[model samples]
Target: MSTPVDTPAPATTGAAPAALDVLHRVFGYDAFRGQQAAIIDQVVQGGDALVLMPTGGGKSLCYQVPALVRSGIGVVVSPLIALMQDQVDALAANGVRAEFLNSTQGPDERRRVEQAVLAGQVDMLYLAPERLKLESTRALLDRATVSLFAIDEAHCVAQWGHDFRPDYLELSVLHERWPTIPRIALTATATPQTHREISARLGLDDAAHFVADFDRPNIQYRIEPKAAALQQLLKFIRTEHAGDAGIVYCLSRNSVERTAAALADQGIAALPYHAGLDAGIRARNQSRFLREDGIVMVATIAFGMGIDKPDVRFVAHLDLPKSVEGYYQETGRAGRDGLPSTAWLAYGLNDVVQQRRMIDQSDGDAAHRRQLSAHLDAMLALCETIECRRVRLLAYFGQEFAPGGRESTACGNCDTCIAPPEAWDGTVPAQKLLSTIVRLEREHRQRYGAGHLVDILVGKRSPRVAELGHDALSTFGIGADLGEQEWRAVVRQLLAQGFVAVAGDGYGTLVLSPTSADVLGGRTSVRMRREPIRASRPARATRRAAAQPDMPTEAVPLFEALRVWRSTQAKERSVPAYVVFSDATLRGIAATRPDSIEQLAEVSGVGAAKLETYGELVLEVVAAAA
Candidate 1:
């Protein structure tokens, strides 16, 4: 027989079995979700891991449980101080020993926290990545027995990630200082490239990787053509999802402010949130949203990185995000509580042109630019697709979707299922449009936006047409059979189908792409939707009444009273009425007849502030009505 060597003992001496018992007793949950248990077990067994989970998928428990169940202290490197405080407060509520060190903490409090860590009084320590860059912090880590290093929102380590942070690049230094410590990196969103970059940059090449399904089946995804987006958004909020907690993401700070103001004017309880606002204001707004219920936050990309709110019922994108990854992460914030939710977006040709211009203007290499363009094109295709939005979304994450896969494979709750559009063949018109673009180049050495080009094609004799003398050209008057609107629709379809390209520098001048030749030469056919004439004011009024039937007859009077109450209360507090109660919530209160404080809490959009301030007034209105 071969000489038997001494086998290594099981690595259980440092494992905190008593802490695992505490996890079960305090949280009242028996087990973890999906790969959470495996990841936790591995970390407890002294192994590093990288986890990719979707929003509301319990990515927090992967590290949270390990932090509680491991020996020594668990150091979590996070980015936002507000998010840190939220996490710490939530943990403290559950009887977990968690504290954070950042600018938000006073010098004396920081010393106390540091002392707690040294004395083994704290189970988990949360630090901003900026803290890791400090020499003093590095020295502190050298002395403390860190059981694990958890990098939350770990995608920040990659330049290609949507929310890249330069400070995260220095996280590799952790391996040098704590070579024996196990580490785990977790993020709500990351692509394969981002995953590779995170593993490489953080020196977690040998770490176990666990990627959950990217699909959020509870979220109904829908994209509408950009036509009066604010009105469409308001209607959406007022109808199916009235009185629900939601987030409306805008592309700019001004859009955030204006949209929030418009919602307020309409009697919606909403708040504007962006980096431009002071930190205290943003924090207060965020806290009000979290501690209370049914408050809609109109924000930019600056909000909701590590937000832990569970009942976010919907997320609407008023503008296109820079990439599909960004779009997915932001939209994923909805329906986190496993309830039905909606992901609504309004996109137009202008969004595509603006995104292209930003990419071309960026100071990146040619390869990077090409990659960015390809990513944007993919996102555009997803937006215009008629199939299941969830299928297309998951495919972008490298997941193969089966055809007709409806068993949790596709969310049947989207707009396509609700109201499918009619499509028509426009191959002949598409060919004519391409031919017009070519003839225009031969006639005049100039590029034009879509409007002027459509004018020339449809033979509209405007001043610009007379000045250019384009009525004399053969292609100008020949295409008058199609209406101006019809020709414009053809152009839009051509752009979406990739038969034409828009110039990046000059507000998107029309340019023919290689695919144009295929359409012009009759090698490929094109089909498009007939451009629907916009409804007039009377038609809109008729449609709105027919579309939404839940608005009770009592709603109008209740709404008026709520508005008066809100105005008086807002004047007292010196804030907007929207800062008091939204129109939708007031409508619900009016319709539901909530007469008591508990009943008022059940009203949609009646949060803590409104309940504290106008609760009595609302009850009086209900009593008077009764």
Candidate 2:
């Protein structure tokens, strides 16, 4: 006989509820992978946070769950209108009440969304920072029930960032205006300095900072010397990344067009995307790239911010990025779904020279120029370093990547580990270069840039050297034993080693740092990598052999089928296919061959709403494939 007892109902409110409920029931994940659960709890409890997560690190969930579980609306400030729309659509697809307000909408549309906000019908509201600065928009938000504020791409707030937004400077007003609302600022890539700047500028200085590891181990980092870059790119695509969705980033609009045309000539389905293109064309190309498979986007940096495409197998750089942050952010756009991806760059001495020249020629104040030079110098070190690229990159962000064993120290995924360059004792040439700069500074009371100084060292009778009387210096012509290339290498190493610095304004004059005295005084010896000779085609074949494709060949058909299904669903809903299900989700579905709705539910990213909406179709497809 069962005893009759009073049963208590489940308790709610006050104490933290199960975030895993939202994770599994809403987003279809079994659990929080890393710091996600902690981050979600912090925000839900009305605390502020500054999350420095890597790209595709499930950053959305940190705010999304709290937005749903907490009382009122989650206001998200994004820089791009398209990104706002895409994020909202994706949330809606996951059965979250998400809406966006942007310039693309008409008055009637805006009014409808505003009305929904007033009526408490929206869970998340995404707006551009510019829109948030409007008085009328402020009034509307003040009247509504606000839960929390999420600032996406928070690194844009840094004045020194490559993608600086003046509008982002005004975002701190959110905290002042809504003092009670918890705020979270998030970004994909930020160096230590950039991280500090973001927190201060966005008024998140008091927020709890959660920095995830910046290393993308699945990404194979390759830096090849530039010799006929177009041919090298073509060979890479044909041999290594055939039929894969990828981004080819160029430094200029003209290069974007030329690369796109060249890829097309080689029978690859390529599209050009740059600021110079007509707005309509750019939109259409971006849409096609998002919707279609086996399409390569040849673009500039303008094309990749807030791009949520997950199946990008590669991000190849035709030219150098301005900073490690830019390179990290740009390359991060690829393999976001945690699949193996390629980050390939073709760089040379010219790339270094050109990047320096651009910074010098820019019409900024001396301080601004110095800041830009500092950023570029870090990038150059990454390019020229023979150390593990992953180690160097993560170290820049203040994270140590000691992988336990000495064997683990070598990442085994970068060019350095595969084919390391011979390290030569650069002590002799380094001293020569440092002495030349010191001589110029002490004797002439003048500073010269790398180009002029290199001319002086290599015994070139250049006009600048002759006029400056640099040819008569003792250090002059002493380095003539090393050719111009070798001299440039030494100067680059000196700048990198902190033995020399770029000083003064307007095209930067070389100045000796305090550390230069050590090298000049024979207290320090610098060893630099002898740049490897350009590889022949057969040699490239050996490197290619070490690479592996992201997906298995057997899974190709099902992957295509899943893409088609996603595309169809996206079109029916008038949203992007990724809004329906990310490429990562579809790939998971294809690989697992989930034969039943129950099995499908067990897959990551298969939230309850998605299972209810597309379960039967997914099951049928899997069954037919079987």
Candidate 3:
């Protein structure tokens, strides 16, 4: 169990009877994982909690079991309105009374749910944080007998968090307005700073706080130096994750559309999803991605929050992520069912330049820009580091790790761990690059972006370089021993190391930082990674052989049959197939090959209501396969 670190634990509510009963009867889990029992017990006894568990660590159960065991409706504050319906339906499938109120509902629909709440028919009530600010909504809740309050994605209240929402700042009013209604704030991703901000902002200073292990041991983290990014992404998918559901994230709407189209052209079931698309199109795409298998949703980050798909095999980034928090949460979306998954990113020079330029041009004080710069710096270091990826990742969240149990690798499951990169002395390459920038500034009284600087270093007398007379400089051709790519790597690493600064117009011109003088004076040595060159097409066959598919040969037929049954049931009910039963659950059924409903109930994810609903149909499918 992950213990609560440096935070107060709520005194245990002695002798709780129905908590475990609700767990096994309602959700069909025999026992709680990690800190769920303690967190649930606290909430069930009218004590507050602040939970920071990773995605798919069963964060929902922390609030849910308590909601069912205690009296009155559990008021849940969910940030995403679009996902509320699916969430409510998933609970209903588990035989729990759940309802949601948001802008999408009609007046009659809202009234029906309100009447249900008034009559004490609702067990959990999902509301948007913005709804709490409404006077009429407050009065309605005031009249109803209220249980504990659940603030989902509670880290949004922290201004420095990756997904900041101003509306979450108002959530402290839940404790004030209903002072006795114990409020439990929950988020899957939170740094120490974000955690502190959440406690301060949500008035959870006295609440029991819990932090689960942030490391996802099942995910193999790999960062490639970007070269023909779309091609690299396609090859990765084809070789390792073909016919498997995944997400391909790009930074812009245009990139999302282009990547989706390109993948579709190659016979993949790809769909584009971003805020720039029409609302109806986005909804339809989201629905298909959820209902159908073997989909690759090419999207911006806008498409992933609140998504509960448990079988996502990989998450590929065509562009660099903004921060570690954003990257971790986005990657956490993959392999939610505890299967092996890959978190792959194609990172390069332009990503660094673009992020730095954005920070420079952003609207904020110097401190704010510094904050953004710090985040980008950390992200860049992660991409460039030669250490164990999981170790560095865990340390960022204040957890210590000792690397053990190798899996096709040296340390942990990551690119560097498998094929370790050499840390060569970058002093010469750094001096050559910094000399060009220094001479350009001293003699020409101007700095230049990487392209022009690289041309000068490589002795390439292009028209612009000739016109600018940079070819005559002493530093010109000083780096002729290395290729342009190698020179760019030196500059990229220097910028990442904070020895060189990105400054001037929005073009990402390079300048000397205060620390650059150390390299120029030979007072400090620069270290850089020598990444292995990527191979072309023929190597993919080898990768395909090494990569394991999602299912074994014997189970594939039964899994397909079960999927067909789930599809029919979902179509009849007009809900996503996963809402009926997640692919993880189906895979569990196929693997266990249960002959009776009692045996089916023994499988991990076959909850009480699910077993009661589909048990016979699943047994018939298994029998036919046999």
Candidate 4:
């Protein structure tokens, strides 16, 4: 489901001109953003395309325009019911004829939409990939004229993608059955390897592949040490993102409930969402998040795929995400309006230990285990790196991040660039940590996790240490120069650097890697990133400056008023406020304060349909504000 399903008007004879006309007539944008023009042209010309654009880089327009201008109705295969609902609603707001067939609808509603499909009354039709598995669905499509087939979130076809759906594997039948229908597959996040997998699985290897830059410069990335984590998260929301619509991601359902309750106790309008919750509760919470302002949803990874909320100001990670791809995909959900936003995470030594342990215990063959470990390793590299966060993030996706037209370098926006970390030599510290792990495995014939090892290194006479006879070890008290936290940092860095590994078939115990011998033999030195001494939260001015690319001070009143008015319209229409006009468009309206309908129509999001729908109302808001 998306914003631009067309009106099943007569097919235009020309591809480029028809697509360009649809862009201005249906959607509000004057011209295509990034590769939308080329992609749309390719699709309208009845050619297949594989588009890898960023989440908010006008990906919808590529298929939306062609689906409208082409000869017949477009069939879109989407994975999420909420996504389909939003897309159908947004397209309706744009005066486009879009209908979706999903389980969310009753039999009567489905019958009506199905009948419309048969009668050529629908412009674009949305369906879940699971729907295509039914012979009845295939027969319906066989009867209807399908101009194109757009596979949204096409990365799901990859067997190893973060969100893999078995039904996606069967999507290639779209080509097999309707061999001449132009197919377009779109995804927001995919590594080069995943991209290849998507192409091969979807049989789009022969299609035109469009890969836009994966960099999201508006998002400021920051990873903080997880200490007093609940308090830290509370302070972050209170100071950096107060009264903002954002998402908090936790790794477990229990964590989601606890975090959501904690935030609610603190008076934040936060709700919990996970598979364990009642289906109706989950749906209501998701709907509230989409429709209301400043509602924070604390959820597991299950909640976010294909969510189309545009004003999400921040996305916080209470625990380390499993991989770089997962991290990128989650963070991309924020700042979709091209406004400044934040991607914050609280990471610690236990994150590494827990992730490693999970990977070791995960059900898969050795190759799958290795694949999971590789993913965690990449995520750890991102969290532990002393270099610019954006550069490392982009490089992971096989792209070079060039901010402000500079070479691939520091973004001057992330936590690392804003307050660079010190890469101090820890060759001796590495030996001390590795020596402890070595002694535990060799001398005592036992292994332990970081807590026990750090206790030993810091010379703590804990009962476990005394019971295990670790106090008499030669390495005891030798590392007393550093505290327990410092020792844990050393262990974490070594683990991240691969000088040590977690023991196989053990309870998260530290074990030496093959490279540990190199460090112990004095052949390799270690460089550790010193966690900078910084304030737990940004200061008063930082809190005040939460809104990025701050608008003119004088326009504040008008903007807020317009927001209130937009909220009213959305509630009345029962659609997301963004489906009416994006924050960017509202900002444009506020800045221009256009009094006439013609002037208001010139704003970026005000297409011909919306111009006729809400132009007069917006003019009234502007006039009343004046």
The candidate scoring highest on lDDT is: 4
| Model 2 C-alpha lDDT per residue in residues 159-276, reported as the tens digit of each score | 8887999999999798898999999999988877787788778777667777877778778898876768999999988877788899999999999999999999999999999999
For model 4 the local lDDT of residue 286 reads 94
Query: What tens-digit string does per-residue lDDT give for candidate 3 at 166-272?
Result: 99988878988999998889988887888888888998877778877776877889998887998988888988888989999999999999999999999989999
Itemize residue pairs with steric clashes in candidate 3: none
Tens digits of per-residue lDDT, candidate 1, 1-626, equal 01111111122222245444544554534445666666777788888888788998878777877777778888999997787866776565456688888988888998999988888888889999998899988888787878899999998888877899999998998788788889999988877778778878987777777777777866778887776899999988887567778999999999999999999899888999999999889988987776555789999999988877766878999998878899999988887756567798988767776676778787889998987887787788777666666777877886654535534444555665445546787888887777777877876877777778778778888899889887776777666888875676667667767888887655778888889899889898897765333322223235334533555665667766766776676556544344456455666777788868987877755544446656788798777767
On a 0 to 1 TM-score scale, where does candidate 3 land against the true structure?
0.94
Instruction: Report, for every candidate in turn, its global Cα lDDT versus the true structure.
Output: 0.76, 0.82, 0.85, 0.87
Give one clash count per candidate, in the order shown.
Answer: 5, 1, 0, 1
Instruction: Report the number of the highest-TM-score candidate.
Output: 4
- Displacement of residue 148 (Cα, Å) in model 3 is 1.2
Q: In candidate 2, where is summed lDDT lowest over 10 consecutive residues?
A: 1-10
Q: Which stretches of model 4 miss by more than 4 angstroms?
A: 1-15, 535-550
Looking at model 4, the pairs that clash are 2-87
**TM, every model:** 0.79, 0.83, 0.94, 0.95
Give the deviation of candidate 2 from the true structure as CA RMSD.
7.4
Model 1: how far residue 343 lies from native, Å: 0.5
Write down the TM-score for model 1. Answer: 0.79
Q: What's model 4's TM-score?
A: 0.95
What is the Cα-based lDDT of residue 44 in candidate 3?
90
Which lDDT value does model 2 have at 430? 84
